[model samples]
Each structure stands twice: as C-alpha cells, then as structure tokens.
Target chain A: MAELVTPAERRRLFTLLSPAYLWLLVAVFLPLSAMLFFSFLTDMPQDAPDWGVTLGNYAEFLTNPTYSTLLAKSLKLAVTVTFFCVLIGYPCALVLAKSIKGRSREALFLMVILPFWSNSLVRIFSWAIVLRGNGVLERAINFVLPFDVRLNLMFTTDAVVIGLVHSYLPYVILTLYLALQAVDDDLIDAARSMGASKLTILRRILLPLSLPGLLAGAVLVFVPVVGSFMEPRILGGRMGTYYGTVIEDQFVAVYNWPLGAALSFILLAVVIVILAAASPVLKRAQT
Target chain B: MSRVDVANVTKKFGQAVALDDVSITFEDGGFFALLGPSGSGKTTLLRTIAGFYFPEAGTIRIGEQNVETVPVEKRDIGMMFQNYALFPNMSVADNVGFGLRVRKTPAAEEKRRIAEALELVQLGAMANRKPSQLSGGQRQRVALARAIVTNPRVLLLDEPLSALDKTLRVDMQIELKRIQREIGITTIFVTHDQEEALTLSDRIGILKAGRIVQAGPPREVYDRPIDAFAAGFLGEANWLPEAALSGLSLPGSPGGRRFATRPEMLSISAEAPGEGRNAVKGRLQQRVFAGAMATCLVDVAGQQWKLVARDRDIPELPGGGEVWLSWDPADTLAVPA
Candidate 1:
C-alpha cells in the first residue's frame, strides 16, 4: 500500500525536482525569452544607441530572397540526410538486432555507435580529408582501377551530406535496432506458415510493426540536421551558405543579433510542428 | 483434405537431437494428438510438419507432393500458435482474411469465406473488433477462424487451449472437437496434458526423448499400455505385490507376467477371503474424500496400494489398521517391468 500524496509530499517532490528544472529554466527558458525579446527589437542594445522595438527583423526575412532560399536549401539538406540515414541505417539495425547473435553482436553494435561517442567536429574533418580532391579516397580508387579519376567531393553540398550522414547514421541505427528487436520471432514464423512471401512479411508485418521507432529516429536526425552549422561550415566551405550559417553570420559576422534571434525562433517553431505531426505515429508504434 | 505421411524424420539443433528418426501419419480428416512431457519433442514434430523446420533426413509427403525442401510459404499449411498469434493491428475480419488476401482471392469471395469461417467459430458478431478487445476464448475462436479461412489441407494447433482457465478450457475443448469434426480437416494437436490428449484425440502418439513410445486409441493406450512408461504417463497405476502373488493371485488370472491395476478399479472391503475375486489385506494409510467419490491409501506388506470407491462404500477404518482391498482377476493388467 502507498501513502497518500499530501501537500507535504508534493512539496518534497518539488524540492527534489527543483534543481534540474531550475537549471532548465535558467539555461533554456530564460535564453529563449531573451531571444524573443531581441527578435522584436530593431537592433542589439549593446551596440546601437537608437535601438527600439520593431518588426523590421522579421520583415527583412520576408523581403530578402537570400534568407528564405537558404532556409529552403537547409530544409532540403535535412530531408536528404534523414532519407539516407533511414535507408542504410535501418537495414544495418535489422541485421544487428535479428541476424547477428551473442557476443559478436555486442561488439558490432558498439562499433556502430563508436563514431557518435567521438567528437563530431573531428569526424567531419576526417570526412573532409578523405573526400577532398587528390586525397586518400582518390588515391585508393586509382590504386584499384587502371585509370585516374578525380574524386573532388570536398567543399561541395555532397561533402556536407556525406559528413552529416556519417555523424547521424549510428544514432538512428540504435533506435531502429531496439524497435526491430521487439518484434516477436514467432510472428515471423506465423507469417511464413501462412504462406506469406518474404517481401509480404516485411511489408505487412515488419514495416508496420517497426514504423514508430523508424519515425522516431528520423525525427532525431532531421531536427539536428536542420539547425546544423558547424558541419556545413567545415565541409560545405564556399558551397555551405545554409540557413544555419546565415543565422551564424547575423550573430558573429554581420552583427545583426536581432535578426538571428528571429530566425532561431522560427527554426524552433518548425521543429515543434514536425514533432507534433509525428507524435501520432510514434504512439501507434508503441502498442 | 490430405493424408500426411512423415517417414523416418530426424532433426537436430547443433549436437543435440530434437527429433530422432520419427515417423507418424495423419489419416485424412482424422484428429490426432502428439502428447509428451516437456523437452520431449512433441512441438518440434508439429513444427516440422508445418514446414517451419526441415528434417536432416526424411521424406514428408503431404498428399502426393514431397515438401521436404519446399519453403514454408509454398507449403500451404495453417498453424495456430500457443498465443494464437493474431495480427494485433488488424481487425478480426482482416486477420482471418489475411491468408486469403495473400492468395489473391477476390473481394466478394474473400468476404463470403471470412464470414463463413467466423460463423463456423460462432464469432460472426465480433468480426469488426480487434483481437485485444476480445476475451481469451474469443481470441481463440478468432485464431481458429483465421487458420481455417484459407482451407489448408491440415490444421496444426500448438497448445491452443492451455492459455484458458479450467472451465473455459473444457468448454473450448468441446467446441474445438465439434469444429474439427464439422470442417473435416486433418488436425494434429500438440500438448503435454495427458487428460486433454485422451479426451480430444481420436488417436494419440505419446513421445519421449524424440521417439514415439505408443500410438493407439485413448482407451487402448490407457487400458493396455505396452510398457510401464505408457501406463504411468496416460493415468495412475498400482503395481500388484510380487511377494504376496501366490497368496493373493486368483487361479484364473493371467500367468507369467508382471501385473498392475488402476486405482479406480480396486474396491475397499471390510471382510477378508473373497471367493472368486483378487483380494489383499492392508493397513489404511489415508482416506481422501471428495463429494461422492473418495480414495483410500492402503499399505499392503511394504508397498502402498490405492483404492478409489464411493464415499459411502469406503468403510470407516482407523489409520494404520488392516483393510481388505479387492478387484476382479479380469481387471488385472500385464505390463513390462
């Protein structure tokens, strides 16, 4: 039997949770509030003397084609990376969870996740070195083939995609592996005994069953990739003028802190909408 | 309907043998049960027949075709799992209609067959409900409907009723037998429950350590089991005392073989020296009374003999006091030691 939760018990719970919630309040809510306030202003208070609350920061985004174009490009980039991650990572996760057995599965699973544990910046840099023109990747290809070929992928949109895919693939694999593992083996056997073809089993049973986890992993990759700046800065080089880098330019280079705050708030709004849309699917996958 | 023949089937998992050179047949439209203790390979044989497993050595003939190397999907069989294995995402009608859909049955025909199958199982009203919304017995009916909707040659049931409570299990048992008889599909059931096997199957094959111990009708196997394991496994038994054989053995009893009698066959007597009946004197160890029937535990010489009779027929005997037990010579059964 449990004791009734009285006002004193409620106070105790609040005390226990206050430290973590208070940290979130100071670290997340306060900064978001400050950004909202700044987005409404004409200029940063620290630099301009004649600063006043204005809608010009948002109006600039509406009028300027460059910011909206780059935002569309960033959204497209996030979609491409999420597609590849789910495509390649889902099969890898299926093999890890179902085909592999015992000790080697553990070792292989750890190897798949080993990349995310390392510095993401370092991994992106490594991709830059391997994919650059006349680099190790080209040299290896030349050694294998009889003809010389230029594999100049660095500083291109392709380079940014490659780098981002490498960084986010492992996390999605982990999510999908947990989902595929939960699918009962007997269900597969039952399907087989019913004369369902392999493709039919995967389509009718496996896909429907594991959709929630797959969607969850897709969301995880998409949200981060949309706001990604450092990867594009390093890998995209001259080609990497995404919405994130533009937002960065406002804060660091252009000194338009008010505009950056408004753009950041818009990105947050998009992320919330995406999560709200996928919540129904995620909830269905659980049962 | 097809008469399935499994000839000399052997299966192994690593070095451990799960089935060893086993052979059994199912008469077309006959209900058969594979009964055994756990780890006795009854379920393994059922799975092999269902084509979930391929034997290392054997020829499995379903009617006229050899299905030893054939894949499961092409084998054309319907199986009900221990948990019923109904697709939770689909409604009852859809779940039952899944196999028909896979076979590309037309919409109208599929609907008619699905409706007929559900009607056969008496679940026509619950066709739109999900399996989760149904009770245990209802889910069982749904599984049966799904398995039979395709009209597979044989139906394989893996402990389908073990999930239900006692009263429900008995009710489902009758329902299952009636449905099987009505459909006339060759059915093979797997269970470790001996009484369930006896009550349900027209014939039973008792397995032990991957081999068949006995195969016969329920009454034949229960009354005249070829060995001690068969006799003991099917039901209870009390071995006739060898030391007091000449004294207690009637003149007309079968000679030169070990004898045993069922607990229920023996009767309790207050007086000794019966003329034509087999009789023995023993001390009353305990009396277990349940309604009109009661069982008395008696110690004769060094062995304990059990006698079950009517509560009124069992005389009031003090514990550790002598009591006479009797049975006819014809009731004495010979069994291997």
Candidate 2:
C-alpha cells in the first residue's frame, strides 16, 4: 500500500530515524560489542603485560561444573519468582480491571503501581524489615495468636524471592490489567448467554485472549530475575551465591573481566533461547 | 419452543427506573420487536428478559419455569449482541458449538449440530474460517448460527442487523425471519429503526420512557397508535389542525383530542375533495422529488403538514400555490394531546 518514496522523502525519513538509531548504537550495540570482544580474551591488556586474545574464558565455562550448576540454580529461582508473581498478580489485575469501576479503579490502580515510585533497594530493605526474624510480621502474628512462634525468615531463598516479587509484582499486574481491560465485556456476556459457566468462560475465552500480555509479563519478570544479584546478595546471605553473584564477583572482587563477560553472554544466550521458544505462541496471540 | 412472559417487572439503576412495571408476553414461535428511541428502555427490557439484569420486583416465566432469579447461563437463552460477539480465538464451527460443548454433548452430535446450524445460515463452507476472516454479513450469519445451534428456548437479539449496510440489512432481515420461522423459537429483538421492526416482526411493542405505549400486530400498531408518542415514533404523523377539523364528525370526544393522519394517506389536489372525505386548504410550501415517491410540504393554518405520494401520481402545480390535503375519515387518528 505504501507508494515508492522520492529521494527527498527518503532523506527526510532518514533524518527522522537517525536520533533513535544513533542512541541504540551508542547505548546498546557499543557496550555489547565491547563485552563480546572482551569475552574472548585471556586477560585484561592493562593488567597483564603478556595479554592475549583467546577462547580460554569460554573454555573455562565448559570445563567448570560449578558454573553450569549455578546457572541452573539461577534459572530455577527465576521460574519460581515468575510463578509467584503471576499467581498473585493475575487475579488482582482481573479484580481491578473488571469488577471495580470509575474513580475507585483508578485509586486501586495507583495503589498497585505505588511501589515503582521508590528505589528498588529501599523496597527490598523494607521487605527485609518485615520478613526478618522477630520483626513486624512475627510481632503482629504473636500479638494475634495465643502461643508464641519463632519466625527466622531472614537471609534465606524465601526472603530473596519475597524481595524480588515485591519489586517486580507491578510489571505483571500492569501488563495483565491492560490486556484484561482491552477484552470486550460483551464477549463474556455472550459466552454466558450460551450457558457457559464461569470456569468455562475463563478457560475458553479470557485466558487465550490475554495470553500475549501474560507472556510479556512473564518475560519481563523472568529476564531480570535470572540475572539478579543484588536481592540475593542482600537477603540470601550464605545461600545468595548464584551465577549472577559469581559474575558480579568476577568483575568487582576477582577482577576477571573476560570471565564475567563470557558468563554474561551465556546468560544472554539462554534468555534468547527461551524467548525464541515462546515467540510462536506470542505471534499467534496477535491475531 | 417456549412463551416468555414478564409480569410487573421493575428494574432500577440507582434511582433511575429502567423498566417500570413492564409486562409483555412473547408467544411461542412468535417474532416480536421492541421499538423505541435511544434511552427508551427497549434494550433494557430485552436484557431483563435475557436474565442479564434481574428486576427489583417482577416475576418472569419462560414456559413453565420462573426465571427472574436465574442467571443468564442457566436461563437457556441465546442472545446475539449488537457487535456479534464471536470469540476471536475460535473458528466458526467452534463458536457455534460452544454451548453444545458446555452442555457436554457427544463429539459426533456436536459436529453434526454445528454443521446443521451453519447450513441453516448458509455458512456451511465457512465452518473452518475464523470470525475475523469473514466479512460483516458473513460474521452476522455466523453469530446467528452460533446463537441458534444450542436450540435455546428463547432468542434475544439486540439490534443485530443495525451494523449491516442498507442492502445487506434488508437481505439479512429476510434471512433472519426465515430462520426464525424454520426453528420456531420465541424471539424478542430490540431496534430503533421503525421500518426494520415493521418488516421483520410479527408483533411490535413500542416503548417510551420505559413503558409500553402500544403493542400489537405490525399493521394494527401502524394503523392505530394509542398516543402521540407512539404515532410519531412508529411513523411520520401529519397533524390535522383544529381549524381544519371544525365541521368534521371527529372520532371520540373532540374536547382534549388531537387528530393526525399518515403521510401516505393524504392526497394533494388543487381543488377540494368530494363527499365523505375530509379536506383542508393549505399553501404548497415545497415539493421534494425522490425516485418512485415524492413529498409535498404544505402550510395548513400556520402548521406544516407533510404528504407523501407516488411521484407519477402527483400533478404539476404552480410554486407556492393553494392545495387541498384530503383523507377519508377512517384514516383520521385521534390521540389525547
């Protein structure tokens, strides 16, 4: 349907596109290119006089079982956190988008996204205060209950998941809310008129229609959680050693830039593969 | 297969009365239309019967079952929305078979019934296609197929044909009537277009301000509207001025009564009509020439009266000249002002 562009029009189009392309080049491609190049080196050139470019960092990843084990562990943690976020977020989104109306919906939506206003570290530390042993959650439970109980929840995998879910819950809720809001209420009514029960309508009508947004939210939560190091480090304590933390150590503590870059590239490859597997369903959802 | 009756139904949203003690019976296998303007509660009545909204005080019966407290899914009703809400994820066949599948019909029976419904709508070949791939009229046929496949006791249509183009709307109106006859399910449809109601319905109920003003056979309601609102809403009514009714033996007590005649009933002539006919002298203001028909606007005693007649039947007249509008006394409709 597009007509052939004149040369002057092509020049204008190029002028319009240059700024965004230039920003992508400077901000994304350049850094990725540097990392790819550094991933093949044996050592940093400035740190060692006998510096050479080699495949030693990638070879070390293949030889060391510890790297693969930690990578698996990080992927498991990502799946767990994404699962909980979806489990808690989808119903909240449905209630907010469909059941509530007018000004109250707006107010509730504001409350849902209110966590994004504060810094991530501040939110994570707040969770630490509530989830710590003998903290606010424990004190509240004790005051309400007849017997006392020890709640030693600090510096654990559950603590890390709680902090991460608190930080990333809004992303799922926001995406699912937009998708659920876009669904026509009349469609649900039509299904009901056909004698479809509530469960049948949810299974046959709502879920398939909103699959795109659900996948988008899951990917948004999954990618960051896979590469997360700060939350696990702050709340996971001795159990905080993941592939991301090990990659962080190579850059900051160990000063092994080549190994860190190689590990980061591997994580990127895994994420890309997961996305590639889900792209077919996402493409079908568009129609 | 069933007659639907609403008895003293009153539905309110907050303080606004949507349906005020409305009662109407949709007879078995009858095609009924609820005709009204926007905000006139025609759709509200349709939805109330569909069990989408329960009335605050009423008893609704479908066949022998009391259904005022029933949910839409349990009411055994088929409702086609204004927008033809076919599921985007399902094929035409699946959309048609949704209710059957919900009822846990056997797979072979479901397939047979889906094919049968599609065939009824003449969309048998489009079974595998998605609703989005079909054209507007095709999608309408698919919605019809889906609604009827379940063999629901009642069919509720909310302006289903309003979305189609003029030619297609006429074609689908005939198709809808034929399908409804073949199935013989009680149907209640809501529409604002008076012509569509007259063309498609066996009986018409005219609503104004959530009350049924007039309901009867199409010709009866068209010929004898109970009030001015019903008369005006159902068709164009040309008021016969009080001065013009001076010497005529008007129907009913002429005290608080006003008379009106249908546009097509009045004949325009240069001279007064013969005996037993009512005639009024008026100045011809404008004549609009449409194909096959024409409209003459006449000023009768400081009021504009419209007369519609066949273009060939109307004679050429001098511009702004005197004309007489005449009609039989039987054509005079009396309504309280």
Candidate 3:
C-alpha cells in the first residue's frame, strides 16, 4: 500500500492536507497556545514591563472555594439539561425514525433540526419571552384552567435549564435517530415472535444497541452546556453567574486575561478527562 | 405442536389487497411452505399468521383457539427472519436465552434450554461469542437456536435460508427439517425458491396476486398445477403446441385449455419415439451443458420447448438439426389457457 503512492502523489496528498492543518494552527492552536502561555503569567505582558511568570492563577483556583462552587454548579446544570434532553428527545427520535414514514417523516425530521437553523441567542430569547412573568405559557395555562394564576418562571435556574435544553435538544434527537434508524425492524419482529414484551424488547435490544449513540448525544449536550453562558445570562438574570459567565467576565469586564485563560485551561482539562472516560463507548459507536 | 387454521383471511394495504380472502390450514407437526413471487402475498400471509398484521376479516385458529386479534408477543410463535436478526449486543447464549428470560423462566431451566437449543443447532461452542464474531452459517444457526429455545407452539420462517449461499442453504434446509422433526413442531416457512420448498415442505401453498393458486403436497402440486401461473411458477414447463398435440388425448375438452410437460419428463432423440409415447418434432436450437445435467432447447412450430436430461444420456447429434422430444401421456399437465 505504501508503494502504491508515487513521490508526486505523496507530495500532492501532503499539499492537499497542509492548508487545513495550517488553518487549524493559525485559527485554533495558535490562540490556544497563546492562552496557555498567558495562563501561567503573573500579568499580561502587553501592558506590564515588570510582569513575571507565576502559577498564581492556578494556585488561586485551588485556594478559593468560589471557583470550585461555580464549576460544580455548572456541572450540575449540564447534567440536568442532558437528562431532560434524553428524556424528551429519545421518544421523539424513536417516533421519527421508526413509527412515522415517507414524506411526513422527512417533514418531522426537518422540524426536529429546525432549531439549529435559527441563531442560538434568538432561541434563548424566545424561551425567555415564553417563560417570563405573565408570559405566553402562563397565560395559556390560566385561560385553560378557568382561574387566574401568577406563574413567574423567569430569572431562575429552571429558566436557564429550559433555554439550554431547547438549544441543544436537536443534537440528542439527531444522533439517537440515526442510531435507532440503523436498527433493523426485523429484530423487533423477531423478539416479539419469541414472546418478548415491548419493555423487554427495549431493555434487551433497543437500549443496548443504541447505547453508543445515546452516550454520544449526552456527551455532545453535556460538553457544550457546561461551557454555556448566553442562555443562563439572558434567562436567569441576576441568578446567572456560572463558571462560564465568570470566565466571560474576566476577559470582557475585569480585563484579567491571565485568570480567564487559566480558568479556560482548567475547563479544557476537565472536558478532556470526560472525553477520555467516554472514549470506549464512543469508539464502539464508530464501528 | 398445534395446527394453524387461517380461514377467509383478507388483508389490504390502503387500496391494494395484499391477501384476498386467503384460506389455508397447516396441519399439526407438519412442515408447510408458502411459495410465491414477490408481491404475491406469501410474506403477508406469513406475517398475518404470525400476528403482525390482523386481516380485515378472518378467523385464525391455533390449537382450537381463535387468535386473530392476539398481538404478536402473546401469539406464542417463533419466527426466524431472512437476515437472521440476531442481537449484535448480546452473546450467543444471551441471544438464545432472550425468550426464556422474557417468560421469566427459572435461571437453571433457561441455561439448560439455551445449551440444548445451541446443541441442537450444532453451535454449542459459539455461546460466548457475539453475533458479529460468528460466520454467516454460525449466525444463522444462532438465530435458529434463539427462535426455537422457547418451544413456541409454531415456528414461522420468513425466507430464513435465502441469505445463505447455495450449498449452505441446502445444508440448513436438511438441518432445519431434522430439528423440526425432532421437536414435532408445526412449521410454516415462506420462500420464492420452489426447489427449496419442494425439498423441505410436506405441503406447499403457491400464492399469486394475493390469492392461493394451489395448495397440496409437493408432488401433487408439482405434477398437477391448477393454472398456468402455478404451473410456470413452480417449475420449468414446456408448453405443448396445437400441432404437437395432434393425436394426444387430454383430459376434458381441449378447447380453451393448454397442456405442458415438465422439462425432466421430456426426452430428446434424433429418431421418433416408440408407441404409446407422445412426440414432437423440432429443430435443435441449443444444448446447454451443466455438469451432470444438460438442457436441450428445441424450437417446435416456432415455440421453444426445453428438455432436461443427463449429460451422458444425450447422444451425439449434428449441430442445429431436427430432433424428437417425447414424453409419457401421464406426464402431460392440462391447465386453463
């Protein structure tokens, strides 16, 4: 196989790949490398001539409980959002992939992924309008109940969860739908013919078979939700101060580039550990 | 073992009728094959009997109980699909034990039954392997083992051996028959392969366009097809032209009736056959050699007639010349034109 490629062909292959790798170096790795360098500095080298290299940012994170608390809160929020997405998205995916057929399935699948077409901020703001005090949701519920009710859902953790779930639900549905669609309908028929009930079929066949996709979807949702800031800020108001928002504040509000880079680097480390833990299942899903 | 009686079953898909008031009975502990071309309702009939589809109007009885409305899981039937459909996530033992576990069979009994089923299919050593780790034939055996482990009242096979290679299919056919006989279970299988149907089934039901064209023992149906469709679908048929039937005495009035003879029953020769044999004169078009058997294509009165004979039985003949195709009068089949 190695002898199959001539010298000119090898050069052409390298030439084709160099542009993308060069772009990655300039756009992604270069910025990440600069951030990593800044994370260990005592001050920004741009403005301070007396700036010295230090592990102060890292030491601060270990010494202060507030950063850890906010990180833990962000992690909890990620878990909550992912759990709801799976709970709601899996059945929707199942119906789209299996129960519905022909043109309607295509139309419904388009609807499932339609959220991705709109801007994330627009979707988050739309949820804010729906879930606010005396919003559309409360008004509709009050009208149906034949009694007036005051339901204020805005500026809370629940609002943040709702907005984030709305924004990321499509990821879960798309991955799960692909996985469920790959499962042969004949397996279901075979199981049923063997005297297996619906729940047993789900537990023994469908769930185990689609576990890789489910985990893949969960990881997709969890990783993004942990680093989320916009949804919580727009919907949670004063209550929305997660680790991500603090990282945002450091760069934009406090002008503390070193601390923000350090925090960002720590978050990257956490995400890497998670991906490593999930590599086995994700690798199985690939094959 | 139970006898399955499907009476006046009618299934429709939108405006299209998949099963047009079909009715057939599968005798207890007997092997039956539903044979048909694609879109001929053979599979629809099998799925309907398996409780996957409920006919608009029908009475399906299994062991004296009406079960047309019963859902598939409660029907107590075992089905093997064409592609095997073994759970890839499960080990062979787990795949075989699924039915028993579903029924909440005791742990000891489930293990013993899984072992027994695997042993019956000659896949005992494959118990620990995942389905992906097994070969095609081994996976097929695992599927068979999984299907029969629960000892369901009836076994339904939806072209189960069609995915296998030719030689493997023949071997599986014999193995399947042996297992069915050993268990004394009523089995109904669907296949478009007439040879497989004839080789395995005690009874064969030929379906055409949502109707049962003929249903009888393999030999009976093969020898006496009810119509042109059944006659042509089941095996190769050499139609007897009007000129060829000059003195042939056919059953009933000959008008509006066509007669055909099986390829194997017809003999080819350079000279005319002796007395009591019906013979046709035709120009030899082509002789196709296929190892032990050979096919002679004869153009008789501008109509093609095929005669299958042993390779060595065919005598040396000049290329592209006249020949006599002869058959016994009893071998002639008469059907509606």
Candidate 4:
C-alpha cells in the first residue's frame, strides 16, 4: 500500500478535500447556523430595524395546539409511508437477489429503480392523473370487479401515502438487494438441510441478516417524508395541511421565517434522537 | 443409524447433465466417501442424497423410505457446508440448538443434546462465543456440532475439512472419524482430495462424468481399480508398457490392457533378483528426494516406471544410470486401455 498521509502531503490533501468541505460549509452548515440563530429571534432582520432575539417563536409552538397536532400528523404519515414501502419492497428485493439469475435479475432491478430516474414530484402528479374520481384506477377496479366503483382518492391521506410509497420503495429495495445478495446461499441451504421450515429460515436467517439495510432504508424514507410538503399538497389537496406546509407558509406566505426555523430545528432534533436510539441495534444487525 | 441408497439417479440443469444415471449404496453406520474430480457430479450426488437436488430419474432411500419427492427440510438429514456456514449472528450454543428448536424438541432435551454435541466436538467451553470470535478450526467444529445436534438419520459432509490448514485438517479428520464412530451415524463425505477419501472412509465410490466408475473399500479401490481413471484418480499408478510383460506373467489375466502398480510396491537395485519375480532392467531417469522417502523414475524400453523407497533404503545410485526394478507379481494390477 502507499502511504496515505505525510507532512509534505498535507497541502495536497487539503487541496483535494477543500472543495467538498467548502461546499458543505457554504451550502449546508452556514444555512443551518443561520436558521438556528433566526429560530431564537422575533422577526426577520430584513423586515424591521427593531427586530431582536426572542423565545416567542418556540413558545408559540408550545402554547398553540395546532402546531403540535400537525407535527404529530406529519410524523404519523412518515411512519405509515415507511411501513408500506418496507412491506412491499423487501420481497421484491429477495426475489431479485436470490431467485432470479444473471441477465434477467439485472433487467428487473433496473425496472424497479426506473421510477427514480424521473423527478419524484412528476411521479406524484402522474398518480393524480390515475387516481382521480373517474380516472384509470376506478375504471380498472370496476373492470376487475362485477360492479362499478368510484376511486376519488385525489384529496385523501391514502393517496398521499400511495404516492410517497411509490417514491421511496425503490430505495428500500436497492438497500435490501445488496444486503441480501451478500448473504451466502449456502447458509440458507444449511438451515433448510437441518429441517428448518421456509418461515423459520426467513424469520431467523433472512430477516435478521437484512435488518440493518431495512432500518437504513426506513430511516431514509422517514426523514424525508417528515419534512415533505410537495407530495402531500399535490396528492392530498385540502387534507395536506401538515407541519411541513405550516412551516412553508411561515417562510413564503406569512413572512414568519423565525417560526419556520424553530419548527425546522425541532424536527431536526427529533430526527437526530431517533437515529441515536436506533444506532446500537443497527450496528449489531450489520454483523 | 440409516443406510442411504442412490439408485440410478440422474439430474440435469436445463441442457447440461450434471448427474447421469449414478448409482451407489452407503452401508448402515458406515463412513463413505464420494470421490471424484470437480464437475464429476460427486457433489451433485451428495446434495441429492441430502435432498437438496431431487434426481430427475431415480429413487433416493434413507433407511427404508424412498425420498424422491421429499424436500430438504422434511428429510431426516444433517449437512455441513464447504464453508462451514456457521450463522454469524448466533452464539455457538444457539447455533447447535437451532436444529433441535426446528424439530420442536422440548427445551430440556434440546439443551442436553446441544451440550452433548458440543462436547463431542470438544467445543463445550466456548458455547457462548459467536462464530466470528473463533478460529477457522473452531468455526468448523461449531458447524459440525450444529449439524449433528438434532441426531438426524444421516450425516453429510461436503468437503468439510478443505478449509483448514494441513495440520489442523489431519487432526480434524481423526476427530471427525471418532465422533462418527461414537454416534454410529451413516456418513457420506464428498471430496476431491483422494487421500482424504482413502484415509477417512470405510467405503469409497469413485465418480466421473456424473456416473459411478467404481465403488469399494479404500484398499480395493486403490489396489484393484476397475479402470485407469479410478486407478490414477485415487492415487498414482505407474503404468508398465505391453513390451515389459513379454515373458514375465502377472497374476491377473492382463486382458491385453496396460498394467500398473503403486510406486511403493516396486524395488530398485543395481542387480536383478535370482528368483521367479517380476524384474526389469532400466536406466534411472530421475531421482527425487522428498523428505523421509525418495522416488526413482526408471525408463524401461521407453516406458517410465517409478519406484519409491525410504531415503536411507535407496542404495547409492547414479541419476540416469542403469538399474534393475522388481516387484512381486501379486502386487501387480491391470488397468483399462
């Protein structure tokens, strides 16, 4: 191996790493620090000269029941969407990684991830075209059944969840496919050769072995969905006024950037806590 | 204990014939080895017997039950994979107890059996350790313990000792034989290593091109191979040209085929023996001194013959010089042309 670091090499190392680190500082850390500062203020500095530091933005969240309710709604939506994505994606990944072979597996994996090639918001809008009152979904359901059916799912929470699941399902499957592919086929054979049932093999071998990837995919989906405002607004219509939309309103419509920053800071704190709690179990599952 | 019988078993993967009408029988409580070169269907036969790959055209019977349609899980068998395949997440005790748990054995009996199995492998003290925490040899032992804890009717080992270093492998061979003997389980071991097959098995079946070429005890297969393939596969076979058998008659019919004998059975000297023994005069082609033993390649009538002896027993002889090689005719064997 070559030596990775030296006193004279430090200049070259700094040159190689500075571009990415500087981009992160300018693009992420600076904005986050500015948001943290603004979250403790009474108003945006551009709005008035008398603006000063205040805890009123955070206190509004505690005193008003609506913000907490909307936050809970957003969190619940994230949980439901993550659950559906995992439930549907894991088996698809298993079939891709284990059952299919060679060229066909690669083709099918590409098909599964094909949705990710397009913009996610476009996909959500496409779902709106399919799930409207007199749309393709209702017609298809009616065609399958012997009776007429109306699927006015455009403004429902179910529509929002369906769109979100479609958006994130590929991520879960990709993680799980790589993880499942790494598991030795001989281990499954060893288990089956010992009189283990199919369910036993899945519960004890596949699930435990793939848990880390599963949790990673879930966290990735959950974090984005918690802060998502576009998909719900596009698909849920009047029913889409969750915590994310309230924050969006504060920034763009109400001109209350401080309150939006306060809400964004609280959500970030929640995400960090969730990640910290799950890290230990995730670490064990990896091995 | 159970006897496993594979009768006229044929298996094909799409257009490729992996096993072609292979037939063999493993005796009750006998340690049997399926020996062959890679892609010779030795592993296919072993996996078929273990119920992993069902044969296309024949029956596999464990004891008295024909298990052609039986899935691997329903078959009463234990198999150790080539890589050991110890569950990385489970403790040693948990891995051993897995089979018992699958069988729905009572907790108390499962515990006792797991302990007994671990003790049999001499890994009882490391029950709580994960497989990752153990050495390669220890991981192999844990895999063995896990396989046998359920007391299945047949034990299948798929090149189980190939991963170990030579010293550890020899020790494990003895350990494996002891455990199998103690349990009195019918064992079928698959290996391409002929010495491992000869050393470990009570009965050996030699396979080629997905068919059984010969099946017999180790000595029978080595000393009386049915063909040149078997003779050369199990060990070295020094072939004697037809011209060398002119006046010297061998014990067997010779059947107008090549004759061969193990190198160890031949003796080299500066002078021919004054008796009715098979003797030939040749120039020593090359002498190789491997530790403790030496081999001389002798060219007799343009045919190369080999003779092995102890390093000290090989009298001082010039390399590429004239020598006389002799062996008892009874030690002679004939191979198919």
Number of the predicted model whose DockQ against the real structure is largest: 2
Candidate 4 has what TM-score?
0.94
> In lDDT terms, which candidate is top?
2
Chain A TM-score from candidate 4:
0.93
lDDT of each: 0.88, 0.92, 0.92, 0.90
lDDT (C-alpha) at residue A281 in model 4 = 84
Question: Model 2's CAPRI class?
Answer: high
Question: Would you estimate the TM-scores of all the predictions?
Answer: 0.91, 0.97, 0.96, 0.94
1 or 2: which has the higher lDDT? 2
The true-versus-predicted C-alpha distance at residue B310 of model 4, in Å, is 1.2
Clashing pairs in 1: none
CA error at residue B240 for candidate 4, angstroms? 2.2
Docking class of 3: medium
lDDT of 1 by residue, B1-337 (tens): 7989999999999998999999988889989999999989999999999888889999898989999888878888888888878887779998999899999999999999999999999999999998889999999999999888899988999999999999999999999999999989999999988889988999999999999999988999998888878887888788777776776654345466677888888887678856888887788989999999998999888888888888997777787777788888777778756
Per-residue alpha-carbon lDDT of candidate 3 for residues B1-337, written as tens digits (9 for 90 to 100): 7999999999999999999999899999999999999999999999999999999998999998899999999999989999999988889999999989989999999999999999999998889998999988999999988888888889999999999999998999999999999999999999999999999999999999999999999999999999999999999898888776777766667889999999999888899999998888899999999999998898999988888999999988766898998888888899999
Model 1 docking category: medium
* Model 4 stretches astray by more than 4 angstroms: A1-20, A40-51, B242-247, B251-255, B270-275, B279-286, B297-306, B322-324
RMSD (Cα, Å) of model 2: 1.7
lDDT for each residue of candidate 4 in B160-245, tens digit (9 for 90 to 100): 99999999999999999999999999999999999999999999999999999999999999989999999889988888877778
Per-prediction TM-score of chain B? 0.94, 0.98, 0.98, 0.96
Tens digit of per-residue lDDT, candidate 2, span A1-287: 56647998888878999999999999999999999999988888888988888988988889999999999999999999999999999999889978999999999989888999988888878888898888999999999999997778889899999888888999999999999998999999999999999899989998888888898999999999999999999889999899999999999999999999999999999999989998898898878
Predicted candidate 1 versus true structure: per-residue lDDT over A220-285, tens digit per residue: 899989989988999999999899998999899998899999998888887798788878867877
